[model samples]
Target: MPLEIAIAGGGVGGMAAAIALQNQGHNVTIFEQARAFGRIGADVNLTPNAVHALDGLGIGDRLRATAARPEFRISRTWDSGEETSRLPMSAAAEVKYGAPQLTIHRADLLAALESALLPDTLHFGARVAGVSQTEDGVTLTFADGSTGDYDLVIGADGIHSAIRHALYGADDPQFTGLVSYRGVFVRGEAPDLPNLDSFTKWWGPTSDLQIVTFPLNRGEEVFVFATTGQKDWTEEGWTLSGDIDELRDIYKDFHPEARALLDACTEVTRSALHVRAPMPRWSEGRVVLLGDAAHPMVPFMAQGACMASEDAVVLGCALEGVEAEGLPAALERFAESRIPRTTRVQEGSLANDWLKKGGNADWVYGYDAWGALKYEVV
Candidate 1:
């Protein structure tokens, strides 16, 4: 059944979803709120599970080739630089999980996803003004007053999803009382930068105060993730200019290795952490929410992108057996199958109470989205 589908974002998750749906022989369109398609800021880790998901789409190997696979993920003390946790990564990870753990520039990941999508598949400057669903199908209205009709609509628009707000009401994101600064610098910028071939973390006395780094873009660059406790950060927007001095002061007691990385980074980006509570229902009528739009999580576990990537792949599995007339049931089944998994990720990522980044996550890493589960409307 070739159903018409529209995804409400052109980001990694949305693009991934668009491509997966397109592969299923469906008519899919990606509507982006931004004026164009591009990526800015942040480095991302595509662990074994996510790598497997992307591999299902046939682009994973090519994308992984552009990224660096660090040999070890070493967790250390912020002040003393003493090792706290050591885990195998890189080829070792591939041998264990069937896919290599990759640290990549966000741009590289985005490029891979975009390249697979046809040029005409995306519509930029198209903010979703409203979504309307009848018993027959769904339609989306953009801010500019144009309307597009589809048999199904997916809200992949991220945490502040207009489609999610329309389906569930205004559930504003609650700040997690934490702030983070992320930066990506060339390896040469910090000649003394430590552990370029290792996924490293300098854990402060408290969980909120930590600094993590890994190589990206074939070891030509390094990405740093630093966080500290901030009881209230009411600012709006995804990122802002971050002061390296302020970051230096936050971890003043950190090891000299961490300080050297900070001094080497001239610019940084800041964002106040925020997450949404679990939704009682992720779909209504013919519309459904996916990824951060449905279950936003903090970055403590770094599973945000991974979860979204999974959503894109699983949606295809959920829909392949259904016809357009059964789209609602397919969506319901999609939510049913995904909610628990994503809930585990949402709660687990909070302060890393359950799983730490780069730790042993065979259960999380071993999922095969295309082969997971299949559903059909009776």
Candidate 2:
């Protein structure tokens, strides 16, 4: 029996879930608060794990055409520019993990996911005000007081998820005493950067500060992200304008190549990092949480989006062809299977020590969501 499903928050995770469920012959609608998509300029890494899942969702070709496949993942000293470690990525990733690693603009990735959806499936400007579940179905209330009923609801609404709050109660996110400044610009602006063909990170004398740079849009643009320990950052949002001068001054002692990249950046945004401890459960009745809503972590591992996509794939497998009465049990199974992996990732990201010295990455990059879910359900 095909189920009628409603998903709150039309982000990467939500749209991926819709595609997976729709493939299983379910009717899925996504309610997003934003009026329309914006070309928000930040790059996201699509490791082999994420690539394999999206490839199964049928958007692999679109991603390859628009994203850059760096030849290496490099780590260097902040001031001296001494190479500490290098990991093969481009062809090596495909050979080792069965999918290529890609770095793409956030907008481009979202567009690919959005293009895979059916028409009239997305309801923009329909902010989710509240959600409640009855014995028979789930009711989703929009900010304008309109209501819709569905067989199940997915809360992929991000870190500050209303559905999560409704199900688990009011729990606040704790600041991690770290902040990041990020900017993206055309590659030509920073043409002289060394190792332009690789994704490189310059580690500070200690672990307290770092700057990362990589190519995106098939090497036509560059994305730079710098993180440092900060004590008093209160404003919260991904779009808060950052001081370009302050950014340069903070890294003035870095390698000349890194300094040049910062000098070329015309615009930047800063956001304080925050995390919520992983919840023991992710589903309640017909309403469940996915992605950042279920487990929000720092961006150290570059797996935040990847984990969300993985969750969507696993959840879709768990619910395929199930009767309405079995929905709760299926959702519980989905949460049970996903919590262990996501919790490990959440804790690892908080430590922020992924690949700094280069170690075996197979555990993180070689995961296959489709394979994991096979035989676990049905």
Against the true structure, candidate 2 reaches a TM-score of 0.97
lDDT of 1 by residue, 51-125 (tens): 889988888867877899888878777788887677787887788887878888787888888889866998888
Q: For candidate 2, which ten residues in a row score worst on lDDT?
A: 369-378
Please give the TM-score that candidate 1 achieves against the real structure.
0.94
Question: Top model by lDDT, which number?
Answer: 2
The local distance difference test score of each candidate is 0.83, 0.90
Best by TM-score: 2
TM-score of each: 0.94, 0.97
What lDDT score is found at residue 195 in candidate 1? Answer: 81
In candidate 1 the C-alpha lDDT for residue 113 amounts to 89
